[model samples]
Structures are given as structure tokens and as C-alpha cells.
Target: MFKDSKKKLSAPATDTLLANGTSFEGTIEAEANIRIDGHFQGDIRSTRTVVIGESAVVRSDIIARDVILAGKVFGSITTEGRLTITPTGELYGKVAVAALVISEGGVLDGTSQMIRTKDAEPSASTDDSDLETQSGTRKDRDTSQATLQSETG
Candidate 1:
């Protein structure tokens, strides 16, 4: 009753949320954008975007068009578009993404494999100013907490 199928096909997908102070464990498959700001343990398969808030703690594999991470994830993440990790984000598993952006303060403690996107040329380089190829020890960092401003921002 809340949505029409025709409109859903034409309109942009809405954002869905897993709020802070909450915990969940299961598989999630959706057409809309998904955001998490709490604890989760499962697999997430989405045709759209998936955003992990700075306060979130997740242990699941994620497959999405794009992912913006500002939290902690203990599983692999595969994306067709790009995976942007904010300063507070941390990932501990493998990632296969077409594009990746890790802010200065972000941390990734696993292997990252880059895939070629349709838009990228065969000779195009994946090395950008924000990307680095190196090996280092996983630093000991404390997980921070923050409150979500609104559900659908």
C-alpha cells in the first residue's frame, strides 16, 4: 500500500536502515539502498547502494553496486561501482571492487582486488592519488561511536 510497482521502477530507490544500538543476523536482498548503523552478521546482496555508518559493526559479505563504509566490517565486500571508505571505516576481509577510495584515516586489513569496469579502458591505470599498493601490519585502532543524524540522509 505504501508504494506502487510502476513508480518503484521509475523512481530512485529509497534508503533502508538498520539503526544504532540494534543487532541483526540474516541475509538481506533488496533493490533499495541499505544503511546500517548498528551490529549485523549476514550476507547483503543489493542492486543499489549499501552504506555502513560510522557506528556500525558488521560481519557479512556484501555485494552491491556501490558501498560507502564509515564503520567496521569483518567480511568481504564486492561492488561493481566503487567502495568508498571514510576516515573512521575499517574492513578486515577481502574486497573485489571496480573502484576504491580509502580516506587517509581509513583502515583496511585484508586483500583488495580491483576489477575492470565497463567505463574503464583496457590500458587505464587503477593507481590514483588516493590509492596505494603496499603491505603493512594491521594497526591497532579503537572503534569509535557516533549517533546517526537522520535515518535517510
Candidate 2:
């Protein structure tokens, strides 16, 4: 009998919270989402979402897939997906984001750059002889490489 072809989906990402009045100073790296409601003075790196609460005060850089800010931040921020600044938020550093949203009353006192999404691959030309298909189009070599690796193993 043939095995099931579909891959199983993973569970949703979890969230970690830093409660109010808590103060921390160090680097934070996590796979789950994070919500901060206190004072932080270090860097934050996450593969999931990061949220800064209304009463939070941060003085460090943040890198995440998605970011939501509703507090006062005094450092730079980079997001792979979207960055949202709520009405009560105030950001005072540079930002590099794929997409950004700032609500009314939100303040941004620094520069920002819109970055391209990582999902878009480079276009391939058919005039090259490296990977010309029967239809005169270049095949995606990266996809074929991945498939071959998976089949061999």
C-alpha cells in the first residue's frame, strides 16, 4: 500500500508574555510569539510575532516575522512580514519592514525602509542553456534540487 502523500500540518505557534513592571536586560531568542508589557533593554529575535503593550518601554532592537507596538520604543526594528503601530505607540528608531501600518495618534520619529518579501525568488531567463525546458522556459533549479534531495533520502 502507498503511504499518505500529504504532509501533516503543525500546530499553531505559542505566545510568551512578559508581564507589567518586569524589567529585563539581555538578548531574547524564541520560536514562539512574544508579548511584552514591561521595560526591556536588550535585543529580541523571534520567528513569530512580537507585541509591545501600551505600558511597555523598550530600548533595544527587535527582529521578528511580525511586530505590533503599542508602547514607547527607542531602538530599531526589522520585520519580515508586517509591522503595526497602534494609536498609543511611539517609535523613535529606524525601521525595515515588508509592510507597515500606523494608526491615528501613533508617532514615528525615525526613518523607515520597505523591504521585499523573502518568498519571491529571482526570475530565470530561458535564453541561458543551464536549465532550458521543452517549452523554452527555464525551470526552477532550486525546486528540482529540493525534490531530488527529498527523494534520495
Query: By lDDT, who's the top model here?
Result: 2
Task: Determine the C-alpha RMSD for candidate 1 after optimal superposition of all C-alphas.
Answer: 17.1
Q: What clash count does candidate 2 reach?
A: 0
lDDT of 1 by residue, 1-153 (tens): 676554211213448899999999999999989989999999999999999988999999999999988999999999998898888999999999999999889999999999887767555564554233221111212111112334334
Candidate 2: regions farther than 4 A off: 1-14, 118-153
Cα lDDT of candidate 2 equals 0.86
In Å, residue 63's CA in model 2 sits off its true spot by 0.2
lDDT tens readout by residue for model 2, 1-153: 999996432323447888899999999999999989999999999999888889999998999998888999999999988888888989999999999989889999999999987565456544555444633442566678789999999
Which ten contiguous residues of candidate 1 have the minimum total lDDT? 136-145
**Model 2, residue 8: what's the lDDT?**
38
Provide the overall lDDT of each model, using Cα atoms, as 2-decimal numbers.
0.85, 0.86
TM per model?
A: 0.70, 0.69
What total of clashing residue pairs does each candidate reach?
Answer: 0, 0
TM-score (C-alpha) between model 1 and the true structure: 0.70
